[model samples]
Target chain A: MTALSSPATPWKPSVLRLGLHRAALEIKLFNRDVLSLVLVLFFPILMLSLFGTVFGDEPVFGADPSGQGGITPAHYYLPGMLALSTILSGFQNLSSYVATERFNGTVKRLAGTPLPAASYFLGKTGQTLYLIVAQTALLLLAARFLFNVPMPDEPGQWALVAGLMVLSTAAWATVAIAFTALPKSAQSASTLAVLPVLLLSFTSGVYFPFSQLPDWLQSVTNFFPLRWTAGAFRSVFLPPQFAAAEPGGSYGVGTAFVVLAVWVVAGAVLARLAFKWPPQK
Target chain B: MRTPAPGSAADAITVRDLRKTYRLPKGGTLAAVDGLDLAIGAGETYALLGPNGAGKSTTIEILEGHRRADSGDIRVLGTPPWKAAPAFRARIGIVLQEATDSGELRVSEALGSLARCFPAPRPVAEVIAAVGLDGKESVRISTLSGGQRRRLDVALGIIGNPEVLFLDEPTTGFDPAARRQFWELIRSLGEGGTTIVLTTHYLDEAEQLADRIGVINQGRLIAEGTPADIGGPELRIPRVRWRDAAGHHEETTASPAALIRDISDGGRREPLDLAVVRPSLEDIYLQLIDSNRQEPALTGARP
Candidate 1:
């Protein structure tokens, strides 16, 4: 009876410490759901494999008619896959996972616990980064071995890719967290979340080159963060001259940074406002 | 036992004029809890028995800090839950109607991760054992049956070594065996002097476990007392029934024998299919909720 001290004046653990524990739990749970794995990992890798095989070794854009001294379609589409994978991991996977949790009463149970809300969210943040980084690495490896997509020559190009990865993860993860509140049930989470990402990936040029789209469609893509994401990624993967072939005749890298950062801030605010537990009534 | 008024000493939870009103979709408001008052003393196992949508869950959720009351003076562990500190949450454990959403983690994994968040949690092994989840510790939550998941839910709730525990419809989908097993687990916890407040529509469950029962209907406490004496003397009166040439008839009375004699006309004639029976707790509960339906709906609720 006397082994442990009584909880007379209840003490709280540090949020940072608990948050790490939560993150660990989150990572373990990541692979447990088949749907989650498909949403974040398989969909993009499969897309890359299919696209690279379909357009193998063919110099599509920024290539000479002789198909020499220019980028292959595989190389061009590889970066788009990376950008698309990052958002899929960050947004689509996150929304569906949390929506299921809410519908199943996991969120409600956690809210009743002593765990700080910040710690719960911190765990989600950790899960998003882990998924994005893991999915990107795997997608890139598949592209190289499967299609022989070449890497950028400069180390600085790789660093830029990493930075954009961070921005995109933050922007889309927060938006997905907010989006969970919009779905009335877990069944709708997949459709509601994936539809927008699928649409934007088209408008943002993940499905094909931005220059191939209609003029009106090109202008419409300007309003989305993915537009910047796909462009920034292309700037790194393709030769610098290809930047001139972009919508603005340049990579628009600075604007890419700005758009993604804006989404990061706005998404954070909306997530705070819209987060809900199960049994909405 | 008599409950001291709200704000009295040693009360684990107290509510004065608590009200929660929700806006109806078309036009109007439903006062889920309207001017309800409650007081539960420390170490008491109080069962709030109510039908669905009676505001029992609503009241408990408000007490659990998951929702805010539209208007009320409420306190759990001497602090209003909405404004309470982290310590407030630490001192209280909650079992929701549905358990955790994900079935991804093993039993040990889910309990261990949550246990780390508390300053002094019950050992994961101990919680699992307490909830009768010993051999299943390594099993994934999804693989466990519904009853096992509920035991895990209780394990999560009590892992914090909470001073007070709130169980909201904790045994809703359980089989007879599982329900009885859950009652044993709860009874053991109550014996350890933990303050337990549970909500269930099952009257027999209240009779088996609760030290006191409060019957809530239409968001108000219709009756509060020991299970044997609940619904007051009037609701507990015995009934006599018989069939005559005219038709089947039933009569309620404190003295069923006298009523039976009158119906049989002093033994000169027998009332066909005559029977006298004492009302069970279930009867009292049904009558209680039914009586509430006949009452006026308007509570002068403010917009």
Candidate 2:
């Protein structure tokens, strides 16, 4: 590695430099965590096998009122599983990593250095992006090759879904980081973030379709980012006219996109305000 | 005093009336660092001597820009540390109390990555050699012994070739030999024009390395001077011990010379065992802390 000599022109420490350095360190450190490796890769594969087999034959929303199955249950569930994979990569992975780093005093060590909080979070964000992209690709490949799921027909729709996945995950990662900052301990953080996400996954129609759920439960699920993300993802693969054939009505692709985007922005803002690079006394 | 050329021997750290306090969860406040003043010149090795909870770490953390002071004027390499300018940080190195556990990463790989953060970091091999870990570069950090891990901590601290270094209990867990070796490493770094601020519970370590020592108690500096001057050698009266002619053990001191002379005047045939003992640095430190504890308000008053 080449070392830069002390510049004759003194360089003022910029927030950007700290952020970049932090991101680099976070990436390096996260890659070394054994739990992170298992969660990002192994956990998703395990979840896919469990859900794919149990709910395999049943039409996801069960035969439409027209007395015909609109799409294979595997096809609809694959996208939701992929979204779930992305969510885990972002929210679960980031929250736990932050909490653990805080507990271990690694975050305190870094704070003492020249690196600023912004640089650290930026580095963390970079790492999360890298992990999420890799996990998403693997999930997509499995869906395509192993499950024999068809790819989205239109290139535009595919782009939209990809954008949504990246944005929604990035947003969730920020929220997770903020949550990690709030929780006092790693155990608390895991319980607070993991339990809620698991609960949401069940209710938001990731493992099973939303149409089969009771009215009040469906109403609560609609408020969650997972529901919209899954809805947006399904819109990309399912027939455009399929929305008009639904019981309550067609899921609005545009509305789902907007909600996910808003959550992402809100999460980023909250993370900026609440995220503590190092725990306070 | 002549100002040293740029980046040469000069004042590397200047802190004035630095203060930091922690607000308790309930309603009270804990003052960790009360108005403290210190200035460390370039290439000088200074030790901040204090007992546990004496605010040594808090002071060091403020200097390192890790914790913001409640109020004070401070400048490290000509910039406020809490501002934490890259230029300021580039010139200073810090070895934290605990080492980061970047698991499964070999020593070489870990140092190599940290080196990238600095604009001008030393060669990884050189750093390893300096810390006396040349042969174990390939070994994972998890597998290293306690002493070796501490050495690695120092290695990472100095990899950036910092003009000033902050070491917080750098040799706490080391055996005597390892501690001595670590002391020698610190001496060499000081010799090479690196301003060093060290905090340790070991009085011997401070006496062995510090050109100037400052004693802090209850968040205030009680004394700041060279080892000899802070507690005057004259004030350390020698104790005279001897076996009198009657074969009775006797120890007396107002002046050891006078006491020895009196014992010799009443001497018998047998040669008397006589010795004069002056106070060690440990004795002086104890006296200082004892006096400080007795009068809390006077603890901050400079001697």
Candidates in order, TM-scores: namely: 0.90, 0.89
Instruction: Please state the error at residue B162 of candidate 2 in Å.
Output: 0.4
Error of 2 at A40 (Å): 2.4
Q: How well does candidate 1 match the true structure in TM-score terms?
A: 0.90
Superposed model 2: Cα runs more than 4 Å off: A1-8, A12-34, A55-61, A64-73, A116-119, A239-247, A277-280, B1-9, B243-254, B266-273
Write down the C-alpha DockQ for each prediction. Answer: 0.50, 0.41
Quick one: best DockQ, which candidate?
A: 1
Q: For residues A8-111, write the lDDT of model 2, one tens digit per residue.
A: 66654566765676666666766777777786655666676665676674554435688675555566677677778767878988888777778766677666
lDDT of 2 at A101: 75
Worst ten-residue run, lDDT, model 2 chain B?
B1-10
Give a tens-digit lDDT track for model 1, residues A123-210. 8888887888888888788777877777777889889999999898889988998888888878898789879887998888887778
Q: Can you list the residue pairs that collide in candidate 2?
A: A13-B86, A18-A119, A19-A119, A23-A123, A243-A250
Docking class of 2: acceptable
Clashing pairs in model 1, backbone N/Cα/C closer than 3 A: none
